[model samples]
Target: MRGAHSTADTAVQAPPHWLRTLALLLICAAYLQGGLVKLFDFGGAVAEMQHFGIAPAEPAAIAVIALELVAPAMIVLGVWRWLAALALAAFTLAATLMANRYWDAPPEARFMLMNAFYEHLGLCGAFLLIVWEDLRARRARRDRAMLAGTKGSALQ
Candidate 1:
């Protein structure tokens, strides 16, 4: 009985590879679209920055577009994913606060802005989960290597 398998354990299964890929793609979808849109329309990007009252609109626009593009790539490729996800989380939170401004919306407009604000906050939470999972995986790998090294030394 000590070595017996549990029914729940047997039933639990990892998702298919394609499904995982699709999920990551969906998470990055908005960022990819925004970056592409901004890259193709420099004037519009600048206008958006200006609309947000960000000084030096062009530089601000360029920086945002760069992060929107770079972070998603790093996340999908598993390269410094924790850092990329953390960056995205911070960016999303900042952008939501700057753009949503639900608290300042008029009575009729408050509902929409409030919804958008919370939706963007949900995105921030997702990005944070990515960061958390990546860091957890890295720590696990480190611990495993250390354990393996100890076992090797014992055998020697």
Candidate 2:
């Protein structure tokens, strides 16, 4: 077994932290812009909520803007990322279903609406993957800690 590679040794390494951070920041840009825009154009944001048939449009607009802002920041900063990802995923799914009702669209508009629906679904999948990655990393860290403790106690 000398000099032989194990499965763990052959596993692919993750990209550098800076690269991962940059990618996450880039992914969050759209959400940051959206939240800022909504905040800046309060009336328009409210109208948009009304257009989506969200009751009490003002409060709904505020809630959505808050989510858009907070969730993306949490994700980018790697703080409670799994929770943020799950929140964004749920928001995206609800928005997609409400906004992209392709079945109700006029024949001429249905294709574009369907495309948008699928695109949002893809975003949902991406967020879910974020949640999965976060959970996996947490579990790995915990396992490593437990392993280290076991070895330390054994050596003592």
Candidate 3:
């Protein structure tokens, strides 16, 4: 008898281009807004950065702005997507570390860092998905080559 099949047991397909585009756009929007907010209120942002041990706040603020603005575009365009993801990973890691170091601070202050870390976690997951698809494609090519080699050897 044919066993009952479960949908959950099937391997899920990779997301369509449109879905990836939508997700990338949403993430980019949030990052762009964050950069803009920090840029517009430099004094307050600088103070916060200093409190977080990010010395020379102006440069750090500019780097954050540049990363947010450029990386989002790169990710959305699918141009250098992996590099953008890596840069974002690094940025989030720094933010997380800073938050951990200042764990004794007020709860509200700690929350901000936690939020950054959570967002980073999501981004990292997306990056992994992309990489998995790439590796799967390579594995399929290798399998095809091996099958062809076996068939050719059997004919000899």
Candidate 4:
């Protein structure tokens, strides 16, 4: 039955809260470090933005730094996590497309650029996964709340 109860469902164990927090922190570590490094080295950040052909380099650099910092932190803290993860995913895709022009690289540099490009793409995919998980969890909670208000508490 769709609304049948099961001891197996209630018996399922979740990972420890600390472990979950640590995992989230580890996932966001690189971005947090990059953000802090850019914040401390504004000139270098601006130069990077300029290298990527971003106009008004200073403002672009600032915006990048802010996004890099805030999004990762929000994700780790589970505050608007899906939105934060989606923002990071979009930014990663855009930055990777702009900076990792592997197809245009010389033969000698092509391999390295290609690897970097793909790595950034992987990061974008991971961020999107985080977004999906966050939204799924939110929906699950909403469903549970609704069930609690009605005679629908049985596990599916």
Worst 10 residues of 4 by lDDT: 147-156
TM-score of 2: 0.92
Residue pairs in steric clash, candidate 1?
A: none
lDDT (Cα, tens digit) per residue for candidate 2, span 27-79: 66777898999999999999999887888999999998999999999998989
Q: Which residue pairs collide, candidate 3?
A: none
lDDT of 4 by residue, 49-139 (tens): 8888789999999998999899988988899999998998898888888888999988999999899999989888888888898999999
Candidate 4 lDDT score relative to the true structure:
0.89
Which stretch of 10 consecutive residues in model 3 shows the poorest summed lDDT?
127-136
Q: Tens digit of lDDT per residue, candidate 3, span 18-78?
A: 9978977886677778778887887877877788778788788788888877887787887
TM-scores for all candidates: the values are 0.90, 0.92, 0.62, 0.86
Each candidate's lDDT (Cα)?
Answer: 0.91, 0.92, 0.73, 0.89
Task: Summing lDDT over every window of 10 consecutive residues in candidate 2, give the lowest-scoring window.
Answer: 23-32
Better of 2 and 3 by TM-score: 2
Q: What is the Cα-based lDDT of residue 36 in candidate 3?
A: 82
Candidate order by decreasing lDDT: 2, 1, 4, 3
> In terms of lDDT, which candidate is strongest?
2
What shift in Å separates residue 86 of candidate 3 from its native position after superposition? 0.7
The best-first sequence of candidates by TM-score reads: 2, 1, 4, 3
lDDT of 1 by residue, 3-74 (tens): 888898677575797886678778989999999999999999999999999999999999999999999999
lDDT of 2: 0.92
